[model samples]
Every structure is written in structure tokens, then in C-alpha cells.
Target: MDLLNNLALGFGVAFTFQNLMYALIGCLFGTLVGVLPGLGPLATIAMLLPITYGLPPVAALIMLAGIYYGAQYGGSTTAILVNLPGESSSVVTVIDGYQMARKGRAGPALAAAGMGSFFAGCVGTLILAAFAAPLTELALEFGPAEYFSLMIVGLIGAVVLASGSLLKALAMIVLGLLLGLVGTDVNSGVARYSFDIPELTDGISFVAIAMGIFGYGEIISNLSQSDENREVFTDKVKGIMPTATDLKRMFPAVLRGTALGSALGILPGGGALLSAFAAYTIEKKTKLKPGEVPFGQGNIRGVAAPEAANNAGAQTSFIPLLTLGIPPNAVMALMVGAMTIHNIQPGPQVMTSNPELFWGLIASMWIGNAMLIILNLPLIGIWIKLLTVPYKWLFPAIVLFCAIGVYSTNNNSFDIWVVALFGLIGYGFIKLGCEPAPLLLGLILGPMMEEYLRRALLISRGDWSVFVTRPISAGLLVVAAILLTIVLLPSVKKKREEAFVED
Candidate 1:
């Protein structure tokens, strides 16, 4: 009943004329980003972060969140139809989804992806609504020690959840931590590595690095491929919606993915991507046994699991962010940035001081998800047609939008140059067989790690053992150590090498 009242209050705010319009706009823009190659949710949100300054906080967040998950919905269109994945999470979909398309089952595959995403999204929302309050209550009890421990857990989860060499993931994370150290020392009042540049004193711009690496980097890599190398789907779309049998087959996968996602989503970092990979692994391990359609050979379960996981992960990621004010992943980190921009400090206190923002954001999540389904289902046919567009046309336009988006952030042309540089680096990573996701995870977690590390040490009077002395912190550190050992083992290294062949 209290939840109902809060939701009602949220509706009152979300359903207003202006907020509804932003929601629509967000959904459309999100689909566009998802349809394009190279641009992911984080880059999309980061680029537009500056533009939302003039809008109301709730509406702005609704739009940003829409784009984030909306991409999850939109990415499958490209992956299934054109064999190009818009984001890393969608990569597994291309494995079997494109196969289904080749068999003239493209229409069923697209419809299954959209419908499954909708159902899973709705289920994920319900679970989030049920669990958020209790989790928030638990979060309220956290102190500085617990908070620092939680961050350590987040980093561990990120690397544990990342695919490819764990050593590579750890390397990226360490690099990210080092990059994060470039900014000013809050305690010493002295610049550490400013190199005397005023801009360097503020450290690397999140906008610069994220936009460059993910946004511009993707575009450059795409351009490096030959025009004839593009993947194209048949112009004839098979169907607009899935039949009844399809629904029956997909329900189980959705449930399984949702269950997996809900558990992993609360992890500190790599929630959505981890959930997607985990969902795929679960599907593989269980062996849908070529049961109905054969798993990964255009199987509906293939579409449903990852979609369910990604969406559920997107929804549950808010748990840590809203309750603990600790963003588990980049999208939630952007939300924190958004909230901070609005003069709001997100924490356990946010639920008490700004119940409207908290509940309203929660409520808007359901509404935005509903909007995504309504916005995406009918558009699958249209998106499939996009595959018919020439790579020459599509790649440039994508590159242009990334450039425009990055420039729009600070109205600075320097960002455009940075985007190009990162594009080169991104392409290099692709050629070198290094996964960029861990690097992103590291970059996102670096600053927080630094802050917590410094604070924990400060409390312990510069004792280096503070991280291992506290019970919670020690436990988390131990887990990280175990993960490192397991990942670095010879067998795991061999397995990681095999997976890179897929890249």
C-alpha cells in the first residue's frame, strides 16, 4: 500500500505533459543510438550529460535511463538482422540470432527479442519495486568502513564478471585506478600529476575519456573495415510479432535470466554486461538441447536470456546507486552525475530527504520500460530495413553522431579531437584482442577506489593494513585475491584464449 502511494505520487509527476514528452524523445533517441554501431548506453548518456542541465532532474533521468535500456532493446535489431552488434552485451545475440535470420526466420527472431525484453523488463521492474525498500533499509546501516568494503566488492565483481583474460581485466583495472589518481589529492591540497596544465589539475574529463574510448573509438574501428566486409540481411522481413508457441518457449528463459540478473545486478560493477554474459553461459550449460529450435541456432531462448538479463540488470543496478549512492556501473554512475548536477547528493538519506525523486525515478523506470516496448515492437520491421542501408552511408553517419554528441557535451571542439584519438585506440584494442569492457569498468571505478583507499588509510593513521584489517574489507579483499588466483591459473588462461578467438 505504501508502495502504491509512492507510485501514485510518482505517476503524478511522471505523467505531466512535459515529462511525458521528454520520455518519448528519450526513447526515440535511445533506439537511434542502439540501431547504430559503436555507440553504447554509457557513451550516449555521457555525451548528452551536458544537454540535460536545463531540464527538470526527473525528466532528464527518465530520458537517460530510457536510452540506456532502450539500447539493450535496439541492439538486437542490428545484431540479428545485420550481424553487427551495437554493444558488447549484444555480441552473443549475433551468434545465433543472425543464424535464425539466414533461415528466413528473421521476423520471428526480432519479435521474440522485443516481446521477451518487454516481459522480462516488466518482471524485473516488479522485483525491483518489491526489494528496493528492504535494500534501502539495509544500506542505511552502512558506515565508512562498510561503504569502502562495498566498493572493493564492486571492483572484484567487475573483474570476476568480465570475460577474456582475468589478467587483462586486472591490468585494465589497475590502469584505470592509476588514471584516476591523476586528479588532485583531496587531502594534500597538492596536484599529483597535473603536469602543470590547469585542465590536468581537474584530471581527465570523464566526457573526454569515455566519449573518446567508447564513442569515437568504435567509429574509427568500424571505418577500418572494408566496405565489402559489411554484413547485410534480407530486405524481406518475415513477421511483426511472435506466435503463441514462441511465447511458451521464451517464458522460461526470461524467468531464468531475471533470477540470474537480479542476483548479479546488485554487484558493484559490470552488472548489465555481466548479467548478459552470465545469462548466455547459463543457456549454454543447460543445453536447450536443440529442444524446440536448438539453442543458439535461432532459438528463442537465445534472444530471451540475454535480453532478460540485460534489462533486469539495468533495473536492479539502481539498487546500489539509489540506496548506497554507489553506482555499480557506468549508466548508474551517469545517473549519480546527473543527480549531483542537480545539487542532489545521492545516499541513503536521499530516500528520506527526496522521496519524490527516489520513488518517482523508480516509478518512471516502469513507465520508461513500457515506453520502450511500445516504442520498439512495431519498429523492429523498420530497423530491419536499416540493414539494407549501405555501410558507406551508415558508418559515417554513426561517426558523425558520435562527434556531434561529444561536441555537444561541453560545446568544445577539443572533445572532437579526443574522440578521434580514442577511436584509434579502440581500434587498436580490437586488433590486439584485448576486451575494452574491463578498461571501462576500471575507469568508472578508479576514482571511487582512490577516494575509499585514501579515507580508509586516513582513518587507520596511514596503516596500509586498513583494507585487510576491517572484517568486511578483509573479506572482500580476500574474494578479490581468490578471483585473481582463479583467473590467473593456467587452465583459465587457456580458456580465455579460446574465447578471444570469437572476438
Candidate 2:
């Protein structure tokens, strides 16, 4: 009954004329970006941040939330239509999705992604609705020690699960932590790593770093690759709707992916991105029936699993951000900015003070996801044409948009320069065979790890045992340690070797 009441209140808010319009607008634009390779939700969102300032907070968030999930749906379009992944999370989808497309079963491959995403997104949203309040309560009891331990686990999870060398991931994380220490120390009214630069006094802008690493870095990497081999959309494209057989195969994968994603979604750090590949890997590991579809040769389950997992993971990620004031990833960090701009405190107190926004946003996920299905399904014919755009033309527009977005952040050219520098750095990372995603994860979480560590020590009079003293804190740290150890083992090393070995 209480849940019903809350949901009812949410409906009242979400159904408002203004909010609904924004949702449609956001979904439309989001799908546009998703269908284009080398462009992503982060780029579009950052560009729109300035524009959204004029709208009411609730309406603004609704639109942004729509864009987030819509991008998830639309991204699958390019991954299936072309070899290019629409987003990092969509990377695994490409392994089998493109194969299905090549087999002239592109309709089913895309339909599975669409249907699975919608189903999983709804389930994920419900999970968030049921669990958010209780989770926030759990977050409230956490002191600096608990937070420090949790952050430790998050950073470790990011590095351990990162696709490349664990050593490189850890090193990147350490560098991020060091960079985070550049501003004025709150403990003492003195600057530390500013080196007498005024902009350094406030520390690096999240916008600058996020845009630098993800937005600009990506452009740099894309430009380094030879476009000569890139495939253009051919006349092979046809009806976008799936056949009856296509729906039959995708259902099981969707259910399996939903379960995996729901569980993984609660974990900190890139759970959305990880769950997709994890589901794909699991599907491959399972038994292969005689005459059953091969793993990478047009398996509908392959298309279904990762899409469902990623969408489910996306929705559940908001649970901690809204309830606990803890941002598990960079995108969530932006939400923190959204909340702050609205004068929301972003802690457990948020539930008490801004129940409307909390419940409204939660409810809006269901609507946003439904809107995506409607936009991406029967309407997919329009999106397939989206893949026809050439990368040579598209990438330059992205570079320009990123440049304009970074410039608009502070109305300063400093961030533009940073983006160019990071673009080169990004290209270098790609050339060196290092996964840029983990570096991004490290860059985003580095400062938070340091802050929590310092605060925990301050509360405990500099006694280091506090992290291991509390039950939750100790458990988390132990998990981190175990994860770190597992990544170092010979077996894991051999597995990663095989991934690149075929190369």
C-alpha cells in the first residue's frame, strides 16, 4: 500500500504536460546520437547541461533520464547495423550482434536488443523502487570509515575487472588519486598541488576531466584508425521488424540477462558495462545443443543477453546515487551536480526533504524505458537509415561538439586545450593496447577514494584500524583484497592472454 501510494504520487509528477514533452524530446534526440557511431550520451548530456539550466529541476531530470535510457536502446542500432559499437557497454553486443546482421538476420538481432532492454529496464526500475529507500537507510549509518572501505572496494572492483593488465589499471587509479590531491586541503587552509595556478586552487573540474578522458580521448582514438576498411551501409538493409522465431529465441536470453543484471546492478563501479560482457561470456560457456545457434554466428541469445544486462544495470545504478549520496560512476557524478543545482542535499536526508523528486525520477524510468521501446521498435526503419551516415563526416562533428561543450562548461579555452592533450593521450593508450575505460574509471573515482580515506582517519584519530574494525567496512576491504589477489593469479592472467592471444 505504501509503495502504491508513492508510485501514485510519482505518476502525478511524471505525467505532467511539461515533463512528458521533455521526455519525448530527450528520447528522440538521444536515439539520434545513439544511432551514430563515435557519439554517446555523455557527449550529448554535457552539451545540453547548459541548455537544461533554464528548465525546472524535475522536468530537466526527466529529460536527462530519458536521454540516458534512450541512448541505451538506440546504441544497439549501430552495433547491429555496423561493426561499430554505439557505446562502451554495447561493445560485447557487437561480438555476436554484427554476426547476426551479416547473416541477414539484422531485424531479429535488433528486435531482441530492443525487447530485452525494455523488459529488463522495467524490472530494474522496480528493483530500484523497492530497494532505494531501504538502501538509503543502510547508507545513513555509514561513517567516513565505512565510506572509505566501500570506495576501496569500488576502486579495486574497477581495476580487477578491467579487461587489461591489472597493474596498468591500478597505476591509472593511483595517478587519478594523486591528481585529485591537487587543490587546497580542507583540513588546513593551504593549497597543496596548485603550483601557484589559480584554476588549480579549486581542483580539476569534473567536466574538464570527464570530457577530456571520455569525450576527447575517444575522438583521438577514432581518428588514429584507418577508415579505409570501415564498412558503409549497403543495399542489404530491409524490414526492421523481427519474425516470430526471432521473438522466441530472444525471450529466454532476456530473462537470464535480467536476473544477472539485477544482481550486478547493485555493485559499485561499471556494473552496467561489466554485466553485459559477463552475460555474454556466460551464454557462451553454457552447453551448445546440436544444430543450436553457434555462439558468435548469429545467436539471438547473444544479442539479447548483453542488451538486457546493460539496460538493467543502468537503471539500478541510480539506487545508490539518489539514496546514499554516493556516485558509483562518472555519469552519477553528473547527477550529483544536477541535485546540487536543484538545492538537494543528496544524502539520506534527500528522501525526507525531496520525496517528490526522488519518487518522480524513479517512476519516470518506467515511462522513459517504455518510450524507448516505442521509439526504437516499429520506428526502427528510421534509425537504420541513421547507420548510413559516414564516419569520416560524423567524427569531425563529434570533435567539434565536444570542443564546444568543453568550452561552454566554464566559458574558458583551458578545457579545450585539456581535451586536445587528452585526445593525444587517448590515442597513445589505444596504440599501446591499454583499455581506456579502466583509466576513465580510475580518473573518476581517484579523488573520492582519497577524501574518504582522510575523513575516516580524522574520525578515528589517525588510527588505521577503523577500516577493518567495523563489520561492513572490514567485509568490503576483504572483498577488495580478495579481488585484487584473484586478478593477480596465473589462471586469470592466462584467460586475459587468450582474449588478446588470437590477435
- Candidate 2 lDDT over 1-503, as tens digits, reads 87789889888999898888888888887788767765566645654555566688888888888877777777788787777776777878887888877877787788889889999999999999998878888888888788778777877776765656667777766766776677888778698888898777877665666666666666666666677644644455565666777676677778889989988876766678778877887788878656568887878888899899988888888887787776665566667666666667666787777788888888888999888888778777777775666667877777787777767767878778767776677666657766655554455556666777888888889999998889989988889888878867899878755542211
TM-score for each candidate, following the candidate numbering: 0.91, 0.92
Error of model 1, residue 476, in angstroms: 3.3
**Model 2 error, position 51 (Å):** 3.5
Per-model CA lDDT versus the true structure: 0.73, 0.75
| Winning candidate number (lDDT) | 2
Per-residue lDDT of model 1, residues 169-267, tens digit only: 677777777777786888777988878866667666666677667776777777777657556666656676667887777778888888887777777
Q: Candidate 1 clashing pairs?
A: 154-268, 217-423, 290-294
